[model samples]
Target chain A: MITLRQLQCFAAVAECLHFRRAAERINISQPALSAQISQLEESLGVLLLERTRRRVLLTPIGRDLAERANDILKSVSDLEEFAHGARTPLSGTLRLGVLRTLGPYLLPHFLPEMRRRHPDLKLYLREDPDDRLLDELTSGQLDLILMASAPRNDDHLTVVPLFREPLWAVLPLGHRLAAKDSLAQADLAGESLILLEFGDGLREPVLALCHAAGSREHADFRATSLDSLRQMVATGLGATCLPALYVDAEALADEQIVVRPFDAPAPARSIDLVWRRTSARSPEFRLFAELVASHLPTVVTPL
Target chain B: MITLRQLQCFAAVAECLHFRRAAERINISQPALSAQISQLEESLGVLLLERTRRRVLLTPIGRDLAERANDILKSVSDLEEFAHGARTPLSGTLRLGVLRTLGPYLLPHFLPEMRRRHPDLKLYLREDPDDRLLDELTSGQLDLILMASAPRNDDHLTVVPLFREPLWAVLPLGHRLAAKDSLAQADLAGESLILLEFGDGLREPVLALCHAAGSREHADFRATSLDSLRQMVATGLGATCLPALYVDAEALADEQIVVRPFDAPAPARSIDLVWRRTSARSPEFRLFAELVASHLPTVVTPL
Candidate 1:
């Protein structure tokens, strides 16, 4: 007996926490929204909202139902989207989640080609840590993701290897390491290394490389982003490691930051395009992945 | 620039993958649904669906946009839900994601009290692995969670320690060790142990206990759930260890499985109620946690 319209009204009112504002959001008169809420409550045999002079509140039942209603409405919306997609494979908006380390350097090179190929395609981009991006990907909040070191073992995911980019030692312009033509792992011995926070996918391996080189991590500081890490190095904070793509795209522009590659046995992270295995857009995603992989080496040399 | 109505219509159509079925899903006449799709495509300046005499398909762009539109609509719905909830606090539905290992043996005992105290509160429950549950907790997909080994170090999470539960060794009723009134760590030496698959929070500690006892995990048979492990022991399979609460509530019901406590220095897993620190429903969660803790020991003896 419940209707989407009633759920919409309830969601609107609950979100606005104001009957008038909710009514405005849904493009309905305030009394009309109130009537819908009453009808929903009556049908469910539970009170969903408690209206005071100053605020509108959701009862416990209201909260539960609102959560379920939101899921249902979203599912319904997803269904329609899937239907439309089946009819026109390359013409709508694409929501992409990319790694903070990879997106800035990677997307600019390939997205223009993607736009050229599918003139009607619109891209919505988000950049975050791999853990957060993968979480949203699994939850259907993100359509596809570009990430590093995807767990190939996860049966629920499909991963397309895009490129493997080496790690570069980022040093202040005039540092001893920067002046060297090339450096071996032993050359970094006793060096102070600063790195990104733990969850970024870039951190663990970078830490491992530093430890292997007999370098110690800076005890007091961990940068939140690659830009910040570069800034720290530029200001003579400490030397650090970054992916080659990032150094090429952003760090090279900074005269104070010098990027140098490891002499041999260089460490690199594999970047991949990953998505839900069950997604209806699998073919399209695969095609997009291939396009990106083919063009990647032109902008950032592949491993 | 996309409106909720257009997105909703698009989602419905995408789901059914058939124009008539999609229109029926939204309770609209097929022609009207078609008109709305046309209008949406016109506004977006792109063709969203491909129509043939017999079927409908999505352009690549259509698929991308549909996914993005779905997320936007869901966000809008969530915003509405949040606003309403701020006014009422705890009276709305509570979505609780609980660990598969703990929920069954724990919730039934205290849920009656939860119902009695806040009859208006509706609990929507999901049981998943700890990693998945924690991810959902952070992403706003779940309201609260009951899990083991709360990562107290995470500043974004607020954890309420409920109780500590001990692990019990389970064996067949007529086994030699089952005759003993109590068991010690050394008693399990040279014994064959069966365990749950890796990733369940219980696996690591159980493996450590086995190693301490000089026992090796059974290589071929890994039980998927506590009930399966109990059944294996009942049928004269290898012995296993389980939480005290699980042994009390579920394993004891089987006539052939015997549950025993350790002599001393028992290994235990701490159980806690966790939610996002920024959750507006913090006060309500705290009160609910208190109520559950008060009723806990009656059903599951605390360590």
Candidate 2:
């Protein structure tokens, strides 16, 4: 029988494609790691890795087995987490994935609250783009994900709405619409807008808003972060839409950029806490979601 | 002839795994996109996608082909960029990949300078982890990458040293060493340090620093961003190391956190501008690198 340790060693080697590096990654001696790999190969009656003087490459079957091994390891990890969750509510480590746009702004407030309330709970955070966050969450690498737009109609996952964050329009200080107390979509007609690139969850909503307002995305420019968008706006490239939480945390103090609210019925996006439905920690996650809702700043409406 | 359009359609389908969504992503009708996929499959004599009423899946061969198609598309993009670069330096869209830890702090200062110097240049930025940045740079999806500790002895790439950034020690306001004028490696012995999780370029250096100082990493917690690290330190989780640019930009004003420089021969990392050696824009990138070095604040020493 192939032990979990064997699979773990193979997975590490498959990922790094270097025996020495993989050995170091797992904190084992190179010869010991090599022995495990050799034993596993002999048991399976197939060669897994082709070793040259300077390079290591996986066989086709090896690649397929490595993926299966990762899945098995993830399942084992989930089982361990389940056992741990049975004994404690929020005391142990919880791997949380958060969106890049939200992590910087929300975590500063949320983490402190978590530290204050659950001192024993140790959170391991990973900030990534929305799709990658979702991928990691589904793969069991992350216990929970906090994102603006939750996945729709996925039976394997549970999403809890945490808040509704308004979208604010950001413009250069000397722009024509900057003097308005509150701007409507119509006011943006024919204006150029700078937006984040595709794959960002915020981009689609901003594109929809631009389409409704007759504004065009600056054909040649797409910012990678909220800071870049603000900088572009500051440099008079074009206006852009930012979430209320981000505006409050990062943009309100920028003298060159003017942030304005929308007219009645402001545009907003739902913030959610998502986890696997099969997770044993569902109850604790739901409770933690409430804590998150309570700790959010007043700029966003908690659900 | 198998057209680029067919490959684009197939790549989109492979990425989204849903025909309707893929078609929408590429801004084409579903039937039109399907026809393109069919044409490509017929020409190649292989089944690329297995489409059912509820889901779209890729065959094993489809997965391999999709990756190759992407590489071809990237090469085409590079050719177009080469032509554009030859026409006018820094006038067209330049896809730049930057490190997540650096972009937020540095771009606010850098973008405005770029705008002032080259009004026609449209910069498309993607801020990701170091590995992803390097992957994109080598894959031709990005014109350049700004990162620290660039890869060594890679003949396929060009590395331009930009600056050296000092690392600072961050502690909670009332911590034992908070009142000290400056800190040294000896002062950090036996301290519990919170560091960013692995895959971040900064983590390894901080871990080495911890090793040299006899400090140990906080095993139970790992932060995802510099902000999270700051928050963790603010809440007295433990001390952490932060780059000088980040300290100058974000952490200087936090009353609860004390940012102190290291004693003589402070720990530091090298920041470099990296791109593929085959890129036709090498001259332009070198000039842009110089501009970046010049715009960086006094907190970091430009190489």
Candidate 3:
């Protein structure tokens, strides 16, 4: 039988893809890595690697097993994290990753309360786009992800929907259409629009609807960041679609902007708290998720 | 932090109610169960159970926590099942529950093949209605279920569809509808139908449509078992709707019976293998499920 240590060693080595580098990453001797890999192969009755001292490459079967091993190792790690997270007063490292766009605005609303409630929870926050957040979350680098509902594939993460925020058109207060009571997709056909690129996670729904309506604006301004999109919108450059939660009274203090209903058959984005289902930190994340989902409804939704 | 052993004891005691019965159930002394309950209360800083020589009942918080404890225990049981299933090939007590209507026809067709394939799998085959099968599946008594899609409250189980079996209308030889190349819903609405009832699991869909169309015919007979249904149909009692897979070559060999296409948005049943999502048995059950799902396209729809 292969030991958990062997699985850990193999996973660390497989991830880094370089023997010496993998050894350095895992803090193990180079020969020990070689021996563990060899021993793991001997136990499993399958050759896992092809090493020539200079280059180490995974065999075909080795590659498949490595992927499976990663899942198993992750499960084991999640259970360990679960045990560690089960302490009474909640004193431990909690790696938090929030999507770049939502992070700046969301922190003001929820994190303050979370910190106040659990002062002992040492939260290490990182701001990144949803894609990187998802990748890091799955790999055990991050415990929780605060991102928009438009996740393409959510295989590893258990998604708990926080709330559905109705789509509101964000535009400069001085724009001609801003004065209108209600705006429809057809109304924005000739108007200038700004949208985030692919990785920002809001691009698909924006592009899909625009394509469906054959909009003529062609998204004249593209911003890689959500904050950048907001900054541009504040400057009177173009209109953009955004969730209603961000433009509440406090957020509105940033700039003079008109938020209007986008008409019938409108779109809504689901803001969700997603964490890897196998994370031992899941219950902790889940409790936190429930707190946000239940409590933040009043402040977060664009009622 | 509640120890797993304490939760197990609490659950057993809760189920048994009598201290001695609970002790016997857990193979522990009565004093130990009482001790663990007291220790659990000490850890939580609250009384969990109200106990006496005569009876045992939960406190308000205990009752509330019983719900969460059930969830946690279910999760743990699923994890153990998953681990055990992964380690061993499908063997031991495999409690398999299948729908009543499908059970007879399906088991005869595939059981022999399945037995030949997995000799170690001791199939404790059960023929039940969908509701019972679903209940048993959720309670962890039944490892896997073969049933049609229905609205089941499943927070723990994962339902993955195996295949969609198209419905075929079976009729007596030289019947008016069978002479036609195809039959529509309208053609059979007013005819004497051998419709399966609640235990047959088709009560809802069949009744819903017939009721909506205002064309329900007075059924001459209803049978709990498929064998009786097949015999009734063979003897020209009334026409019945069945998936193509169950009406095998042997059944079609009946000179007095005929099969025809049922038309106008064909009625189909989606068969799936349902198991606990967190089950340790998932990995092996998935492999077994895959074999069945793969063999199913040919077994169910008829190539």
Candidate 4:
């Protein structure tokens, strides 16, 4: 029978591709780690790794098996988390994955308070790109995730809508649009717009807005972050749209840039708290989501 | 011959996994794109895509071939860029990849000046994680990259040292260490250090510093960006290290946070401008490197 320990050892080795480092990561002796790998291979009747003097590489089938092993390991971890949650609703460690765009701006508004209220709850935070955040949550590496957009109809997950953050137009101080109280989509036509790269959650909606306004994304620049987009705008490179929470957190005080709202029926993204459908901590998660919504900055409307 | 057009059409399809969207992305008719894919597959004598009414999927070998086709497309793009560069030294488009950690803080200091000096030059910027930046540069998706550390002894690239930016300890107001004039590694012992997540160029160095000082990273938190780290510190989560340029750019005025330099032999990261050795525009790139080094903020030591 395949044991969870074997899968854990194999997953570690697959990630590091070095037996010694993998052993160190898992807090085991080198010989013990090697023995488990060999034992698993013998039992399965398939070679999993190719070892050279200087490097370790996975076989083709080994690559596919490693992915499966990781999935199994994630399920086991989720089971353990379920057992822990049964004993204590919110006291144990909760691993949370978050979108890079939302984490920085949103967390500061509520993290300290959350920590104060649940002193026994330890939150392990990992912020990543949107796709990776979903991947990690599905793999059970994260107990929950906070993102601007949830999968439309993912059957395997539960999503709690937290808030709606409006996208505001940001421009250099002397730009022609800066004089307007609230810029309409048509008002932005013919302007040079800057945006985040394709994979960023904010990019598509911002691109759609630009397209609606007849504005073209600057052919020469795709910012990596909201901060980068702001920096470019400050340098007079191009105008951009930033979320209200982000603008409130950092840009409100910047004299070099101007932040204005869009006309009614403004572009906005829905922030969600998502977790696996099979999670045992659903009740606690719902309560936690309520807490987040209650404390959200006034710039965003709670869902 | 497998024409570039066929590969372009196939790569687009591989990315979108929908023929209509792929055709729209590449500005070709759906039938025209489908014809190219079929002709290419026939010549190669392999089924590249499995098409059904609802969706498209790549075959196992098709996935690998698609990656290769994309690489070839990138090289072709680079060849065109080379020809464009040959016509005018700095008048054409230049695609530059930048590290997310460095771009926001560093670019504003020089980008406006760069635009002023080279009016005809159109600079396209893409900011990505460290590994992706290097991969894109090697694949010819980017002509140049600016990063904290260059790959050592890489035969395929030329690296120009830019400057050394010191890491500073940031703390909440009224914290125990906030009163100190400067801090030594020993002073950080027993402190909880917040850090960027793994894969960020700055994370490893910050972790090393934490290790050297007997400090332990806050296991519960791994920030996605430097700004996120700052926000966490502001909320009294823990102390963190940030680059001097970033501090100079954003943190100096924050009333809730105090930034301090490290003691003698302060830990720092080396910034470099890197490009493929085979690039035809070395002279122009070298001149661009000089201009960047010259305009670096006073907080860093230009190399």
Question: Candidate 1: misplaced stretches above 4 Å?
Answer: A1-88, A298-303, B1-303
Q: Per-residue lDDT for A102-121 in model 1, tens only?
A: 88888878888888888767
What TM-score should be assigned to candidate 4? 0.37
TM-score of predicted chain A against the true chain A, for each candidate: 0.70, 0.71, 0.63, 0.71
Supply DockQ values for each candidate: 0.04, 0.01, 0.01, 0.01
Which one wins by lDDT: 1 or 4?
4
Instruction: Write out fnat for all predictions, comma-separated.
Output: 0.10, 0.00, 0.00, 0.00
* Candidate 2 residue lDDT tens string, B1-303: 355677789889999999999999989999999999988777665556655456666643465567767765564444334333425566656788998888888888788988988887778899988889888776556778989899879987899999888999999989899889899977999999998976557898888898899999998899999999999999989999999989999999999899999987888878889987766557778889988988989988888
- TM-scores of all candidate predictions against the true structure: 0.40, 0.38, 0.35, 0.37
Complex DockQ, candidate 2 = 0.01
Question: Model 4: residues >4 Å from true position, as ranges?
Answer: A1-303, B1-86
TM-score of 2: 0.38
Between prediction 3 and prediction 4, which has the larger lDDT? Answer: 4
Q: What tens digits encode model 1's per-residue C-alpha lDDT throughout B1-303?
A: 334677778888876778899988889899988988888887666666656445666654666677777776676566455544534435556889988888898898899988887776778899998899999887667879999887999987899988878888899878889989879988999888889886567988888998898988988899999889888888888898999888888877777888888876876678889987766567888998888888875424453
Per-residue alpha-carbon lDDT of model 3 for B110-227, expressed as tens digits? Answer: 6666778777666788888888887876654576888888454765667777776766777877677887888777777676667776755565566655664455644568766555
Model 4 over residues A1-303: C-alpha lDDT tens digits? 444566688899999999999999999999999999988776565556756455666643455567767765554444334333434445556788887888889998888888888876778899888888899877556778998788969987899999899999999989998999998988989988898975557988888888888998889998998898999999999899999988999998999899999988888888899987666567778878988987998889888
Docking class for model 4 is incorrect
Which runs of model 2 end up more than 4 angstroms from their true locations?
Answer: A1-303, B1-86
